[model samples]
Target: MTDVPAPPTPVTALLRAPRHRVSPRARLMWQVAALVEGAVAIGVLLLVDLAVDQVDLPWWGVVAAVAAVLAWVAVVPQWRYAVHRWEVTETAVHTQSGWWAQEQRIAPLSRIQTVDRAEGAVARVFGLATVTVTTASAAGALEIDGLDRARAQDLVAELTLKADAVEGDAT
Candidate 1:
């Protein structure tokens, strides 16, 4: 006889709902960062091309490198922005992110060791912040980025409180 797991409850259903999304400005920030990175990559490739030219190497190599970088810069940010999402429920913190390979993570409150909030210079300019949740799992910390500054702070505070309330082996 095969064993079947029990069906999801109302709470789980609510938690699984695709209702939560990152701040809209996150897309802009991600795109802008991508552009900056792309620019740097292009600059380096151009320098490499210059050196290669001096050696009479194939110009196609440099063109290919720049094309690859441009494609990555153009596609990845939009894909990530469309997919990234996070939700904090009473039981756990759920996050979904990534571009080509999607990833979903759930960190239960009981296993949470700490909650932290951070803001980079670019994020500050956009009034954005990232919340990092440390857990006992071997996977290390989970970061929920691109949240509005105030929302990130609230999430950090709430997660801290929840983690405090739970009793577990929070290694």
Candidate 2:
């Protein structure tokens, strides 16, 4: 009797094996950013409270508001750091990010139109960079943030080379 070959596994299964995590510095950066945002939010809330002096807010209302802001500033950055991950394979660039709502995206090398590296003022201070991969999809580009500056540059070069090597449309 002739032997039959095993069925090929789906690409999704292969892609799900594991993911690489971002640097610990990412958490620090996020915490700093979150603190800044929390401060702004608290300022706005306080201003609103002052403007509506006709109606006095309960003591618990003010306490809860402050507590919520503090909790967000203290917790969200760490949660985000734990969830954000990225991996570059021969076939695709996979990225997963989010805290409350998770998102995973895969961009095939063949679909890559451009690989860009960007640095914001805060990121520059931390020596971090974000790598953006533009593809043909309508959802826009995929971003891999919190990479070291050198690592981001290397990724850009590597993606560029891989995209160039692939000959067909990745759609």
Candidate 3:
């Protein structure tokens, strides 16, 4: 006789959605970046199709790839802009991020191990940065991307000070 599968455990949702949306300029930043990425992807595909003599890549296949790129460039950034948000309270840092697969995270100040900011070439050009909050949790670090550059700097400094004030790091 086969063993029966265990029932899935029900989990309570503890955190509410964060209060603040990212900078409005974030949408333009995301759109530009996506366009560059899509162009590179299509260029690479064309190169591969040209280089491979054994395979005659059909016209429909090329058309489909370009269509997919255009759709992603048009859609994903707007979706992500709508979904992404972040806030920091005295107790915790809350964030919601991603487009297709979203994540909502809350990291307690006491559990915070580090706070850092990052800016890619594209992001820097757009005057945007990402803030990462490292916490002593199994779920991993929480990141809030596409924040205003100065705002990100302020967040990093504020989190560092607040996290330092908390007693024991629950690590």
* Predicted structure with the largest TM-score when compared to the true one: 3
Instruction: Record all residue pairs in model 1 with backbone atoms less than 3 Å apart, i.e. clashing.
Output: none
Q: Rank candidates, lDDT, best first.
A: 3, 2, 1
Residue-wise C-alpha lDDT for candidate 3, range 1-171, written one tens digit per residue: 999997765554456779999988888888888888888988888888899988688999989988998888788889999999999998989899989899988888999998999999989988999998988898999999999999999999999999999898558
Positional deviation of residue 107's Cα in model 2 after best superposition, in angstroms: 0.9
**If scored against the real structure, what TM-score would every candidate get?**
0.81, 0.86, 0.88
The sequence of per-residue lDDT tens digits that candidate 2 reaches over residues 1-171 is 999998999877765622788777887888788777877887787778789877667779778977887788789888988888898889889999889998889888999988999998878888999999999999899998898899999989999998999987766
Query: Where in model 2 is the C-alpha error above 4 Å?
Result: 1-12, 169-171
lDDT of each: 0.83, 0.85, 0.89
Q: Per-residue lDDT for 91-162 in model 1, tens only? A: 888888888898888988998988999999888999999999989889888888899999999888899888
Assess the local accuracy of residue 120 in candidate 1 as a C-alpha lDDT between 0 and 100: 93
Q: Count the clashes in each prediction.
A: 0, 0, 0
Q: Give the better candidate number (1 or 2) by lDDT.
A: 2
The candidates, ranked best first by TM-score, are 3, 2, 1
User: Can you give the lDDT of residue 49 in candidate 3?
Assistant: 83
What lDDT score is found at residue 41 in candidate 1? 77
Give me the runs in candidate 3 sitting further than 4 Å from their true place: 1-14
